[model samples]
Target: MIEPSPVKKEPIGKLISCVYRTQLKRMSRSLGEYGIGGGGQYSFLKAILMTPGTTQDQLTVKLKFDKATTARSVKQLEAAGYIKRSADPEDRRSHRLYPTPKAVEFQPVLQALLDESNARLTRDLTPEEEDQLIVLLQKLNLED
Candidate 1:
């Protein structure tokens, strides 16, 4: 009797998409208590905290997000009292983002949660494997 054809392997893009969706869900749940919306909200907060007074336009480029996304995130963060936006001195139309005292106090907890999440993601991988995976993943240039 002929053997049945082996199941086709899932593409790398499909696997990455699945992992991305799961990661988003996990992050959303993890951050929900703090009123921090997911879909890279933590990333925006961290960047602003690290580099206070960065404008939304700069964040858009640095984070590889579009203007609308950056604007929405900034608005949500501001609404959550995690950040405040000031008019840019050099540009009337631009706003400089700054993390609020609330964000500062929560930074440690935020970092700890992020660290735990990352550790969980790579728990099964050896340190060497994790390092190698990072190197390989970084090689994938998805930029235009």
Candidate 2:
């Protein structure tokens, strides 16, 4: 009897993509529970929270997001009452991002939600493995 060839595992990119999709889905649901829109809001919120006076252009560059996406997220966040935009003092045409009190009050809880998402994803991995995974991920990011 001839033995069949051993099963081939999926490529690294495919695995990574799957994980990314699932992670986003989980985060969307988790964030929704907190009354915050999901998808791209996490990065926007974190950036605004960290730098109260960040400009839209700065946010686009820092987040590496396109102008359109940054604009849409800003509009959504503003409407959600989590953030507000004002004319930049130095640049008359540009606007600066600021977190509203609602955002500030919920910031800690939002952070915990982020932590929970990460903890859930890495629950099975040991401390050393988790550290190694983070380093490997950073290296992959640097490649891009």
Please report the candidate that would top TM-score against the real structure.
1
Residue-wise C-alpha lDDT for candidate 1, range 1-144, written one tens digit per residue: 224469887888998988778887888899999999977898899999999999988999999988898889999999999999999888999888999999999999999988998899899988988998888899998887
Residue ranges of candidate 2 with Cα displaced over 4 Å = 1-7, 141-144
lDDT of 2 by residue, 42-142 (tens): 78989999999999889888888789988888898898899998998888999888999999998998899889988999999889889988888878853
What lDDT, from 0 to 1, does candidate 1 have?
0.91
| Candidate 1 segments exceeding 4 Å error | 1-8
Checking candidate 1 for backbone clashes, the offending pairs are: none
Local distance difference test, candidate 2: 0.85
**Candidate 2: residue 134 Cα off by (Å):** 0.6
Residue-level error in angstroms, candidate 1, position 8:
4.4
Best candidate, lDDT: 1
